[model samples]
Target: MIQYLWFDLGYTLVSTNREDVYQKVLERFDVFRNREEIAIAYHRADKLFMREYPGVLGKDSRAFFPWYIGTLNYFLRLSLPIEEVLEVQRDVARECPIQWKAFDGAKMTLRHLRSLGYRLGLISNWDESARAVLARNGLDEELDEIVISSEVGIEKPNPDIFRMALSQANVTASESLYIGDNYYDDVVGCQKVGMHCLLINAYGNRGVEELSYHPIITGIQDVAAYLGHPRVQLEINR
Candidate 1:
């Protein structure tokens, strides 16, 4: 029986769909921009950084904020100070809070799982302030454990993060399951360390087509029923 559950943050617990976040940023900046246009701009900025900051980006491929700011600066063609870029980062984080809301059925599933006495933990490739986002969304108090790449200096697919979560959860890898969106990062990741896993794919990920091993969920609610929890039938009033 599974006793512990580790979850991916982006696209799992929270929805960081670039288009959704871009719309909020445009609104906050008063730019009067189209969401598609803004997303393209975001891509341009990141493409520049990947070509430029090879060293930094090489070491940390999941440097989300850096890629975000770099892409913004490059696309906007503005030469703002890194500190100013950071201010914009903080502003986007705070003002665009809705971009990071729990998925349609996530909060209720988490609450139900918690009620069932299952140990829930979060593992994400996020910065030091990830805890703050989790706190803002009220997911912090609900989780029994957390492992962030920025804090631990190691990232997912590395297994060290899972090891740490194992230490905190006091369970064996075989006794736990990890749920994430990314194919390589979440599914292959936790599995590399011998943990059973699930991939939460809302978009019907095509990359998983060849993978023969893991179960996939289109929504977090599916996981509750898969867990065999009869209380999983409760509706999420959101």
Candidate 2:
């Protein structure tokens, strides 16, 4: 009975090309950290930043860079000037949109869902760059609406953003399905708003079969079969 489908952007629709991003950082910025060092520092900082701003959405550069850079500096144990850190942050912000790529079958899955008459939209905890990334990857036009954390000033793991997305689509909570990669943000958030959610454990890294309020899918293409589409059944059998 779902009439609307809303998806999370990062790790769901498209993911950052971390290797490329790391290479760019090393080449463009003056840093002594090796690739492995940077990777660990980056993940630690990223996780900390997400924790700090769980329900606030905006561009990472503008809203979350300060804390991220601080964490990076600590991890690297380097006393970088604020200006240098800001410069690096800006570079990351600029490069991410260009480097992000949609997952295989993402567009096909979205188009398939649209053809089924289920309204498609995006609910992301990202900044303005997401629009460009989506447009560049041919996903922007396919969505009926996009609610970003930066634009709405509310982030995932908060029911208000889910409410906003539903309001924009004019769909009731019970009539919508929210899909995302993060358990706390997508599943917990949407469930709080009384909406059904599906987790996208793309690599099966979660090691979880199900949640109390939602199920899990390995890919967007699998969503078709989950929804009982005959075409998807054929695809699955093949």
Candidate 3:
């Protein structure tokens, strides 16, 4: 029944490891914080920032570096200026690659799904840089629709964003299967609007807790197959 496939860009389609990015930037910039301390501090600040502005922030946990640096300056007892914090943000954005490494099975999976005649689209809680990543990975040309939080002025877990994506894809919630890594944003959001949802739990992130929703996979390849592919061997025989 799935007419369209909505892929979440950050963790589901392309990848970005915040800890890896932070370490890369720190080393590249000659920043003093070691890996472990930097990792903890970054996570703490990120949690605080997300709690503050979930819609305004993004999937890149390190995107709040400017505000985090400014806040931490007051807490760490360092007399750093705002200009220095700005410098840090600029440095990170430039030095850190914001690299895009597509999931292992992504390319082949997309081709297989398209061959089955399923419409492909993207919905992401990301910024404009996502287009570059998609272009590099060849998704920009493949997807029929693309939506980003920054472009839409709303982040995930919000029904309005899902509505926007469905509108562009020319399909109702009932006809779409949206897949993403985050439970609340991906699963709960689309489910509220009557759209089917799947959690691409690449890290098996459900932990030990029981989930209210069932049917998840560790990769986009699973969703692609579920929606339309049904294995190339089956198609070849037909």
Candidate 4:
């Protein structure tokens, strides 16, 4: 029996609207890079940041802020001094809490699952700011546990974080279901720990095709259908 359902945060239960945040920050410095350019730079920055910083973020916001500024400066190639870039980064960080929000069906779906006797938890690659965001959106009360990468000192796709989550949930991997939007981190990460998993493709964004072993939902609301619950007869319309 499925005793627990763990979810990924950023694109799973919550929507970051990162592009808006990026745009707002960039505008402060009069940087007019097009969306495509920003996307390319941000992607490059992410790879480098993950490789270098790993799980240092979230443990202490003070340390990560500089790393974030450096990453942005490197990608944007703004040639600004460290101080100038740091100022921009600080501003961006301050605005992030207001930017993150829960998706439309996230709370309702979690509540529904809880009512059906499934314990709910969260395992995300985020930091302490996640606490405030969850609390602000009232999602904190819906979760039984929250394991963050910064707090746990391990990031997803590493398998160790997944193991940590399972340990916290007090359930074996086989008896839990992990859901997230990221293909590698959420799907492959949980699969590494032998957990059943699902991917949420909210925007209908396409990149990775579904494998025979991979089950997917177009939105969080469709989770009940995937669970085969008697009362919630929704379908995966995608």
Candidate 5:
């Protein structure tokens, strides 16, 4: 029986409007691409980094963004200079510092799970800005505990962080379930601590299916159904 539920921040509970941002930046370079095209390209690039680079996304932005945008451009087949795009992206970031927004049904699902008697928490490999992002999106109050990498000086895939969350929640690993988008960080990290985990592959073909022994969900909204909560199903039907 799972009494506690934990989550990853990026691509799990919240995500940036990468497609919109990328589209706008591309337009400045006179490069034309639809939002769907940009989104697909970004998804491919993101999966490559998540699988190959592992913790690159959690690293310093100065290095990470250039590499990421370069890869995204490859997938998008864009010839625009990477540095120019980065400059534009920085401007966009400054104007909209909080780019993350809760995914559709994220807050509802989390609150619903809390109401269903599960302790909700967050274990994310993110900078100090994570708390502000959660609060801005109204997700902070729904979580009972939030353990971020920068704050604790520890990151995921290390058993210590998972242990920290368990200690804070006062629950054994067996009584908890962690859900996230990254397989290496979320699934493998949970395995190290003897905790069950679920992967969220919104695109459905991110190459994790072959590597993951655990269940994979499309989004946070599927948690109630996955956990066998009939009330959520009933509400959805009506």
Candidate 6:
């Protein structure tokens, strides 16, 4: 029986719409594209980086954004120079620092889970800003612990981090469940520590259907249903 619930921060409980940010940045260069298409392109790029270039997202923004935006541009067929893209990204960052918002129903789902007597915590590969982001969205109050890579010097896909969270929560791996968006990191990492896991594939195109070891949910709201009926196959709600 699952007694403790842990989650990843980015793309799981909270996310910022890069499509909107990139769309506005592209307009400055007279490059217009469909917002939906941009969203798809960004998703593809994100999966590629996450799977092939683990920990790339945790690097300094100066090093990370150019590579990420370049890949995004390639998917969108923008053909813009990386230098120009980087400049626009900087301008946008200055004008409006990237804000991470909790997903729809994220707080409610977490609160419900806690009320049901499940201990809640966070295990994320984020910098010092993880706490601020969670607190800004009022998600921090819903969690019992928050373990971050920057603070622990360990990252997911590394069993040590998962072990740390389990230790901190004083829960056994057999009684814990980890939910996150990354198949390679969250699912694999938690499994290494003998914990159950669920994947959050909101877009349904993350290419993880081939792997059926763990269940998948479209969003955090589906988590409640999964917990209530652990044996039921969850239909992708996207």
TM-score for each model: 0.67, 0.67, 0.67, 0.66, 0.91, 0.89
Task: Give the residue spans of candidate 3 off by over 4 A.
Answer: 17-98, 208-210, 228-238
Q: For candidate 4, what is the TM-score? A: 0.66
Candidate 2 local lDDT, residue 112: 87
**Top of the candidates by lDDT:** 5
The sequence of per-residue lDDT tens digits that candidate 1 reaches over residues 66-104 is 556656755655445565546665577675553566666
Candidate 5: residue 133 Cα off by (Å): 1.1
Worst 10 residues of 6 by lDDT: 229-238
Clashes of each: 1, 4, 0, 0, 0, 0
When superposed on Cα atoms, how far off is each prediction in RMSD?
A: 6.3, 5.8, 6.8, 5.8, 2.8, 3.8
- The better candidate by TM-score, 4 or 5, is 5
Can you write out model 6's per-residue Cα lDDT over 1-238, one digit (the tens) per residue?
Answer: 8999999999899988667777788888988988889877877887888788887776886778877888888889878988978888779867767678887777877877877788999999998988889999999999999999999999898999999999999999999989998888899899998999989887775645456656888887787788883322333334
Residue-wise lDDT of candidate 4 within 71-129, one digit each (tens)?
77677777656676657656886867437778775787888899999999999988668
For model 6, which pairs clash? none
Best by TM-score: 5
Worst 10 residues of 1 by lDDT: 49-58
Q: Give the lDDT of residue 196 in candidate 6.
A: 95
List runs of model 1 lying over 4 Å from the truth: 20-98, 231-238
Question: What digit string (tens of lDDT, one per residue) describes model 5 on residues 1-238?
Answer: 9999999999999998878877777877888999888888877887888889988878886778888888999988977788888888778767555378888677878888999999999999998899999999899999999999999999999999999999998999999999998888999998899999988987775655457356888888888889998534323421
Q: Estimate candidate 3's alpha-carbon lDDT, on a 0 to 1 scale.
A: 0.69
User: lDDT of candidate 4 vs native?
Assistant: 0.74
Give residue 59's lDDT in candidate 4 (0 to 100).
51
